[model samples]
Target: MELALSVLQLAVRILALPVYVLHFLGLWSWICKKWFPHFLSRFTVMYNEQMAGRKRELFSNLQEFAGPSGKLSLLEVGCGTGANFKFYPSGCTVTCVDPNPNFEKFLFKSIAESRHLQFERFVVAAGEDMHQVADGSVDVVVCTLVLCSVESPEQILREVLRVLRPGGAFYFMEHVAADRSTWNYFWQQVLDPVWYLVFDGCNLTRKSWKVLEQAGFSKLKLQHIQAPLSWALVRPHIYGHAVK
Candidate 1:
């Protein structure tokens, strides 16, 4: 019985090898950087429009603090395709930092469409190394769907805390590890290696909130959301604010 199980696991891994090779070899990254943003831009635009209720609810927290005057300074890490641009209050200036340089083009296009916000600059830097953004420079640091894929969640959070002005908020929306009781959690563990390869290093089992807690936030608020599982690997989500 043990032998049979071993063989099955080996087979599963073998079947997933192609994705690993493509991703680690930089081919997948190249493709995603080049064309994936365009596809994601369209999908998010449609998805956000269709799911306006949920999107609005998630963004309302940001709107409350940033206000309508748009005077606040905002820094968005992993500002993919500028999905959050539409939600910013009018006149708020934004500095975007993303590791993938390919995102800059799409982000600029999205900025053009976002009349409420002003673009200060785009820095091609990872969340872990944002030295270009001075400490305590931003009133609000926004991170949506980014921590799960970063190389080190701790370092990223540290940088986040560093850059945030005292009493400034860090708003995040992240898909997190599922509850252990679920079959989906089992699958997430079993398929984690391949999933990371195919999805640009997105870990299916990261306890992102724990990382947030350990980062020493003065205040942390999180809302656990179990969205109807369209994609089993990324169904569990946490959305809220953490103050530094």
Candidate 2:
């Protein structure tokens, strides 16, 4: 049985070789960086409209984290197009981090539109390694729809912990793997490889909630719900906050 499983995995890898080649040539990254931010900007309109109430509730008390300047320092990892800017409290000093430099223009547009927020800077870096952000320098860290595509969720969470001040808050929302018995889970398992290739490394079967639960947060308030997205495969979502 083990040998059969190994053989199956090998076959899958062989089938995905073209994708690996494109990645090696940097063609896949280039294509995604050029187009994905534009796509996300369109998608964010629908997503934000649907998630407004929940986001408002989640971010309502950010004033609690405000410093002497009457503003809270916020770090947003994987901040594609700055979709969360409108949801943040006024006077937030936000530092945006994303691996793709191409998103900088769209991020600037969002920042321009969100006049209430104070733009700190935008860093081109991945979530796993944000050495650019100092230790315990941020009061809040926001991540949404990011873990599914990241190379390492655990490492990203570690960086989140490292960048947050004592008693800081980490807000997260992510689509997770479906229930084992459901047909959605079966399809997610079957389509994950192709999905990863097509959607810029997003895995449909990532159990991101499990990673967050074990991420050494001093306090965690997690809630699971079916997001009102058109895609059924990504409807199972977990959202909440964790305190450092």
Across residues 1-244, which tens digit of lDDT does each residue of candidate 2 receive?
A: 4475456556776888887788889898788778788889898899898878888888887788776677799999999999899888888899999999989999999999999989999999999999999999999999999999999999999999999999999999899999988877766776677678768789899999899989999999999998888888998999999999
What's the number of clashes in each of the models?
2, 0
TM-score of candidate 1 to 2 decimals:
0.88
Angstrom error at residue 174, model 2 = 0.6
Distance from true position, residue 86, model 1, in Å? 1.0
> Could you give candidate 1's per-residue lDDT for residues 40-109 as a string of tens digits?
7776776566445655676675644553354688999999899888877777889999988887778888
TM-score for each of the candidates: 0.88, 0.90
lDDT of 2: 0.89
**Per-residue error (Å), model 2, residue 22:** 4.2
Top candidate, metric lDDT: 2
